[model samples]
Target: MKIIPQLLFVIAIVIFGYFFSKRVIRIRKNIQIGRKEDRSDQPAKRFRNMLLIAFGQKKMFKKPLPAVLHLFIYVGFLVINLEVLEFIIDGLLGTHRIFAPYLGGFYTFCLNFFEFLALAVVISCLVFLFRRNILKIPRFWQREMTSWPRLDANLILIIEILLMAAIFTMNATDQILQTRGAGYTATGRFFLSAQLIPLFEGASTAQLILGERVAWWAHIIGILGFAVYVTYSKHLHIFMAFPNTYYGNLNAPGQMWNMPEITNEVKIMLGAAGAEQNQVEAPARFGAKDVADLSRFNIMNAYACTECGRCTAECPANITGKKLSPRKIMMDVRDRVEEIGSSNSDEDGKSLLGDYITKEEIFACTSCNACVEACPVNIDPLSIILQLRRYTAMEESSSPADWNNMFSNIETNFAPWKFAASDRFNWSKE
Candidate 1:
């Protein structure tokens, strides 16, 4: 029977690893399907950005109340997970409170700290749920947030609350067992957990043990399950945020990434470089007709988007009732990426261009920087929109009549207006 329990623990670990590894590999593969670009310049600056923006949640602080509330979940979840290492060890070795004897008082200090975080996480989650469900904040009801995105947010908060509750219950029952002179070993009373001691007071040894066991199992297992679930959920930003911020565009908002293929062609045409020097193997396509046509960073940005609607809320186009929603653009990129990654979804020959994101939506963009400035995670929705817009205009030659005339004027007269430079004096005389 002892051997059987050990075998089961090994099997559970293997199952979790298998699923987690598969999801990670799939995401990596999907990201790699995109075109490559060099974002390797300035490693030190990138590191600082990752630390300050992603780790510090600097942008979130602009909104004080929600930022503080979110900080609780961010810090609490991250800090509490350190205890998971001990939980993993204990589970494999069938040891209860494995670090109690080794660390002595320090273990108690750590547990107390974790208890405080756990309590904060629970309270924060409750408040988040209330803000989303009961209060029904306006930004939360944006068009992009109507269905799964809304439910996904609520579900994650509820799961976090339950996970925190299990941790508290586990510690509470362990404290009871310790005071009764049970063999559970004394790790010292955790402050927040101690408050719940009365609930299990006077319970039989068997009942207390069962409660402790259930809570312990629930927390560890729930954490493992959540680890797998994040890869599939919008909550993936938790893991992707660091690297996404590091590779994020550091250019001023108005400085767009020029299409290198187009740039090289232009250099050749202008005689700035000899055809041989400018000559490279032509790409199969230009701009972004699909997720694969986009750069790797853009696909990663899609995965990193928190879908907080800040982008949409700040978008001039969205506010004006245009077809464009910057938030929806990111969400559509992620959804189409998912479809492309799944078997046969790409077989229909439809893509992000006309199928998911419409031409009208792409045309509505005024090249304003509000969405980029408002994104807390530095997600570049405009880049995706412009890429799609480029494909629509340049590759497909489908620009609206007005835009086509503007393009013609710029190409012929070297300006957006149709006129000869010599003829400018006629207007000046008037």
Candidate 2:
């Protein structure tokens, strides 16, 4: 009987180690995708940004309710891990109430509190899923008709439910195991366990024991499987959000969009005029020629996507049916990243700004900053598109006639509107 817990613990530990190591290696490979050397010299600014974004979650609140709910989910998950730690100890070491002495009544209180909070998170996620799927929020819908909007939402809900269920069962199992005296005082505090006890009145010891084992194993298996799922699905945000947020830009949002000097050097070296330099020496032209041109951060952006479709919901081009959906763009980027990561062949190479992402889509952008402002994870797709445009205009000299004329007018007249300098003060005079 005692050996079961020890075996579960060892199995859990081994699985954890294997997954953790694999993810670390994958992230490292992703970081090398775009391979831009770190240029920030301001240690203080970087440190402050790391603290604020990673812990403060400043960027997440652009969509307030979802942000706040997600924040609670994160904190609740972290706090609840202590309960798991205690479970492993009790199950394996025979210390049934290990955390009781150290945490006093606090562990009990937190277990109950976080359990309820976790429930709220699950409910909120369900609402979000409904909004995305049944309600058919237009913003999150993809253009290729290939975006897995419903699947994405369903997966997230499943993860949240599994996590919450695990917590509920673990608590309930403990309650049953300690039926003689309410087990631990902490166990009594959990509302789920308290409610469950009444239903089990007059149950046999063997039945109770069997139920405990079932619940215990269910909790363990659910959590273990969830850990694996996170790495492969959009729910990867569950683990990556903190680290990604920590590395977030500290500078003003606008300032961070500026292409680094390395990008410029690459442009010049390749004789690429504008943003086209992003494709220089690259097999495919820049913007996002295949997925290798995309930075690790870009890949992270996809996993971190909450499928809120705030960017797509706000995109002007989508509203006009111009074939540009920011949400679809994100999905495409994610697909490309996965495709490249999984294959050794270069057959999938595609231009970032060409047929892969149409010129109309490129020109449709207004540089209005709406998409950037709307993204929950701070993904700046607008900047990526613009860089691709720059590469087209500067390196390949392949800009649209209307846009070229507009740029020429801007250089000759200092305004895209083509108004003469003499007429600049006409409005003021009138």
Candidate 3:
């Protein structure tokens, strides 16, 4: 019956692996539903960008205090997970402190290092929770951050705190058991967790053993559960940020992508030389009205968004109290994609443009590209906004009355004024 616990550990690992893999595959499929566009150019530049933005978190440094706090949680959580590797090995072999005998002092040193990181992680989580709930940061309490978004952020912080507590409990109890001449291995004291040893001063050996076992099980199980839950949360940014940064747009901030088909047709009409070179078939639509019409990079951006509201915070239109919130645009796209991916019917009589994101929101954008500059992961909300604008103008011929007037003047007078092209230079005579 001793091996039964090992068997259960193996089974838990298998189930967690299966579900996580399934969720990842589903996300990939959903992202692929959008049209393909080549983002593979400039491998060196892309790699550098991924390193700076995702790994180094260069953009996050814009806000020094939050950035430092985030670094503590990010770096500490990752380092502590290294200890989980030991947990897996011990659980599988039904052994305790499996590496201690081999590494001696080094094993103890590693545990002490992890304890320090765990304390840092716990303290960071508490600060984040206080900021979100007690202080009520404006970005975290935005209209887009409804009940579920707020709850998800708080839950992740709380889970990290509890997981760190479990580690301290397990270490303290194990040390107590070792001193009692129980079967527990004699590892040296971990500096941070050692402070907790006094709490179990008079506990029986059997009780200490039970506490250690319970903590051991809880910590590993909680880590596994957190891994799966992150796949469904805004926390998916943890994994998606790397690839999203690698595939980020390399063009200048103000430069917009034009439809090749339209550009070619315009050249042909003007009888320009080499107009027919590299000519391709026209696309079925001018711009994106739904997720399928958007490029794959745009869809990936939707999933990579952490909903941190940096984009919205930098938006000129949002600052002026317009309906435009760049963060909301990305969130709306992700919600639409999820809805479509999970739907049974192909045509749901709803689209990302009209159903999820409204015309007023898209129209409110000034094409300033501030949101793109503000995004930590290089997500381009402006690209999505421009695509929706194209559909409104070219496909539906539904631009606002003022914009239509400007379009007419540009077509007839070759400028946004009523003066003919021949008289355009007349003002220079003055």
- Among these predictions, the greatest TM-score belongs to 3
- Comparing candidate 1 with candidate 2, which one achieves the higher lDDT? 1
| lDDT (0 to 1) per candidate | 0.87, 0.65, 0.91
lDDT of 1 by residue, 57-78 (tens): 9999888888988899999988
Candidate 1 local Cα displacement, residue 277, angstroms? 1.7
lDDT of 2 by residue, 1-430 (tens): 7587677677776887698678667655654565463535676765665566656777677678768777767776777666677767766675556777678777678777877777776777777777667886665555554445557567767767776765666566567667555344444467855676666656776666666667666666666667766666666766666555545445565663544545767667777778553443433444444445665566566656655677877888777677776766666666555555666443654544564677677778777778777765566676567766767786677889988999998988888978897787889876
Q: What is the lDDT of residue 110 in candidate 3?
A: 91
Model 3: worst 10 consecutive residues (lDDT sum)? 337-346
TM-scores for candidates 1 onward, in order? 0.95, 0.79, 0.97
Candidate 3, residues 243-317, lDDT tens digits: the string is 999999999989998788887888899998768896978998999899999999999999999899999988999
How close is each model in CA RMSD to the real structure? 1.9, 5.2, 1.3
Model 3 regions lying over 4 Å from their true place: 344-346
Where model 2 places Cα greater than 4 Å from the true spot, the runs are: 91-97, 101-104, 142-149, 181-186, 250-288, 345-356, 407-430
Query: Where is model 1 more than 4 Å wrong at Cα?
Result: 267-273, 425-430
- Point to the candidate with the largest lDDT: 3
